[model samples]
Target: MKTELLEFENKHKLLEPTSTERVATLEAISEYTENFLGNIDTLPAFVNNVSEKAPFIQSINFEEQNTLNEVLKNIRLYIDTPGINPASGGHLGYIPGGGLFYGAVGDYLACITNRYAGVRFASPGAVLLEETVLNWMANLFGYSKNYGGTLTSGGSIANLTAIATARDAINLKAKDYHKAVIYTTQYAHHCLQKSIRILGMDDVQWREIECNNLYQMNVEELEKAINKDLNNGFLPWLLVASAGTTDVGAIDPLQQLSEISKKYNLWFHVDAAYGGFFILTNKGKQLLKGIEQADSIVADPHKGLFIPYGLGAVLIKNKKLLHKTHQYLANYMQDASTEKVDLSPADLSPELSRHFRALRLWLPLKIHGEKPFENYLNEKMQLATYCYQQLSNLPDVEVFNKPELSVFAFRFLHKELPLDKYNEKIQKAVMNDGRVFISSTRLNNCYVLRIAILSFRTHLSTIETALTVLDKSKKIAEDELYQELRNN
Candidate 1:
């Protein structure tokens, strides 16, 4: 059998890459992709037995393209097309573009090269790449030459670092500290609260200021809270202002907050995680007024620039602030005497073995001029406004918080319906149908539906479809109520 196989191989000469084979391969792949994409209109449900076993590779020899195709097809089916609504909104899932392609290639190159981004001594190029991005981010926020920040995993970690910096700044100034307070709006992301808790400050004061009708941080309330804390002899360590709140996309009055921070000598940090980079847009720059005055700012490219997830930034107006918090020398890590301006990723944040994530953002900015992002942000703001208008006109649905950025909240309202039970059922109804996905929130005693139009793929049609889903859900609820009344 071995001799026969060897003879056959010699005679066939191992099937060189001929035009016929190439065309056949191309056609096979084209058919598979066409089938997957073309069938998206139907969004058909897929069924696969969990216990099914794939054939062994040895059994297939060389021509296993059919088996590979089946695997790809099955995986594609498992992805659940159109994607799920990120607790935020508008799944905008897996967009393919130059930015995404380059980011993938960068990751591939980094993997092939295996550059360790943690230590400057080991991989100065990788560290420099990360630092160049950080410097770019610092400059983008209008920070001074002295200001700097580190790329972080996401908002939670960014917030943690910002608060840690604030803590270190306070600790340096004060000799004895009995109480520490953190001030932020009630609408501030949960990450701030999480950061405060994680810092091991059991007596840490949380001045959760209320929001105004526009869902922005109430400056008057903020002032009152700060004064009360001061009067009570509690140290106000940090004032965290939300550049864009998670639920309603509200940008707190940063200018006012900054003033309060200055007057009170509080560490000013802006959680711009969701909407910071919108700074490129005329409206965003206008809306995020005084964000530059912040001592530190957190931004997420994944949210605004539409880069794939796992990238967030914390920009400090004073680079010393990061050193105040993170300046520690391990025998192997930092050589303080040399003054290496090139940033080692580990020196900036807690993580040591960090991925070269900055290239995902840096390459995109260099490839597409910043103006494109500005234009895209403007379009997103318009889409949010469009969605708000659509939701507002519907009789049963009430547009609760006017969107300050790209996120807005709405809820079904009726005299007879129980809010909790009714909203729960409506949420399920929308999800079960699966044409579009949205999320819910409880705002001011009512269950609210949140629509965040922040994704790069979100367009007019997607907004229209989402509104259609809302309208249908509302009508279904109303019709059911009428039927119940008639039966009763």
Candidate 2:
């Protein structure tokens, strides 16, 4: 038995590499990432039709040990090269956070230390760091010191946490779920709907308040809907507004919505996942004026702050309610109960074994300071305005929703082909061209292209390249349509 234990211990020692081995591994990884970043500008943002039978997938057996270089080579070929190169400045599709290098370094340090951030007693410093970060965000959004939040994996979970907190704060019974009313425009991020289903409140009345031409929630219609629900014996409960919507980057009239929520005795929750950190900028602060009135707000550092993905936040004005909703106790956690200097993240969020996510945001803010982040966000808004102007000036283009932040929709028109079909062909051409990536969404049942310019790496030059790509793609789509017509 002593001999067997020695053998197992020797084998386990392999997991902790020698100092030289660690240095070599780090150098190799650094080299690969340096080369990748050096050529990021020239890389294609989108790569279409990556095969499932690629070598990496075929050679997926993990039984055999592989060298570090070999693994990185496979990662470069199979993982990074095939999909949308989000690190590329040309990634204008869907909201993007340009994956800060400093943040990655912070992640490395956090993983190396393996500090448990979920409980205060486990690692008080880690917990305090997280608390400091959340407090900064809360103050940025104009919340009082009484506010509390937890860093989540991303906006989806943050929004989920907010919804759960709101539900519990109101003392909403499960039996009343059928008659409970929640209000938001159609443009609210779909995560809210998913949250409702996950919480088993699918029967709750989701009133999609009408939007004005600018895609903001029409407050008058919203009030009418609330009154209608009340008259019909429904309990109006929550109002979810968008600081920046997914499709067109529309900001609902937050100030108006807050007033209505207050007047109607509804819990006002703002889904500012895409636009919350924009509060750092002067313009954004002005635009997001009434956000302070929200009972709860969801923000993604991954989106607005240009941190790498996996850092999101939910700030609730009432800390006690947030704790009440998610707090749980187990016999194993009894050790942490005595150390109550501050509320642990595990008490306020559904997660108990959460990653040390605060380090990523903290390191960047400390290293670069807040000024650069603010400048980048402001630059994105300017670039969006420039792009919108350029697109509107084009002869055959129709720009939709002048970017409330840094995202908008547009469509290219062709006389011969149906508008939707023509735009679809143009989108395909753009993807195939692979110089810049843009996404498409349907608005009023019409296919339209979208550009979301939030990446810190994105600049005026990148947007100019996108415009050139659009022009080139338009010609390609037109020729393809003509060729098909002739063939038929």
Q: What is the C-alpha RMSD of each candidate to the true structure, in Å?
A: 7.1, 1.1
Error of 1 at 312 (Å): 0.5
Best by TM-score: 2
- Poorest stretch of ten by lDDT in candidate 2: 51-60
Error of 1 at 307 (Å): 0.8
Give candidate 2 regions above 4 Å deviation: 57-60
Give the per-residue lDDT of model 2 (tens digit) for 215-320: 9999999999999998999999999999999999889999998999999999999999999988999999999999999999999999998889899999999999
TM-score, one value per model: 0.81, 0.98
Which 10 residues in a row give candidate 1 its minimum summed lDDT? 90-99
Q: How many residue pairs clash (N, CA or C atoms closer than 3 angstroms) in each of the candidate models, in the order given? A: 0, 0
Note the residue pairs that clash in candidate 2.
none
